[model samples]
Target: MSKMIFINLPVTDLDASTRFYKALGASRNPQFSNENAACMMLCDTIGVMILTHGYYRTFTSRTIADARATSQMLLALTVEARADVDRLVGAGVTAGGRADPNPPQDHGFMWSRSVEDPDGHVWEIFWMDPAAAAGDTTGVDA
Candidate 1:
């Protein structure tokens, strides 16, 4: 297994991406950050690299997705409670993100809401209830 979880995101401007992610409660890891790209730490080990399109292309042979006009990443963040899921999704929307075209889904064991970041990256905030899951026999993944 790897020690790091790297999510390479294509951004038109690195600084803007850094600021946008900061608004969503992420801190820039200075040890792995510069003007062209920066590691936005999501957790102790997970990070999303906000790399400039040109700089990121070196890692792949294909063209970068124009995230401003289309989708590229679909990230799911699971919380401990349903209210937390909704609150986090709402916070993202308040910070210039967009909510998905669906309502909060209650899957007996879990509830979820999806949002899109300012750069069109999809994020699903979910909450699982173990007690509800134990009671329901057919609870499926949300």
Candidate 2:
């Protein structure tokens, strides 16, 4: 069987977070959702578990850091094209998320945009042409 990845994130408001993710094209997995937690299916192999701050604390003894003030990690997802990256970012922003404070990246072969969800979770949406990214200097500057 293929390995599946589950990312757990603490959210200040479960309902709002659920809406934000749905706007980005993820669907809620009823099998794993509840009053205190929601399972957002990003795809067949990846799932994001959004837990209420109180419920999240049950898993760890440490205090939850305010994501707005500090970034613990950047969650990245690769899409088929640059447009797809932009689309997700647009959806996120429209749903009350904020774009990354940093400038977008464009390396000829790869393009990326970042956005912060309502709870301040950072997500990087990117796209890369495999051939161009593999050192194929055809039509690209070295």
- Report how far off residue 140 is in candidate 1 (Å): 12
- Which sections of candidate 2 miss by over 4 Å? none
lDDT of 2 by residue, 1-142 (tens): 7899999999999999999999888899999999999999999989999999999999999989888899789899898888998898999998889986557998878899998998888999999987887867788765
Model 1 lDDT-worst window of ten: 133-142
lDDT of 1 by residue, 1-142 (tens): 5597878887776766676667556889999998788999877778989887778888899977655566555677777777887777777777667887346687757788887766677777888887665765454444
RMSD of each: 3.4, 1.2
Q: Which candidate is the best by TM-score?
A: 2
Q: Compute each candidate's TM-score over C-alphas.
A: 0.78, 0.94
Q: How high is the lDDT of residue 73 in model 1? A: 57
Q: State the local distance difference test value for candidate 1.
A: 0.75
Clash count per candidate:
0, 0
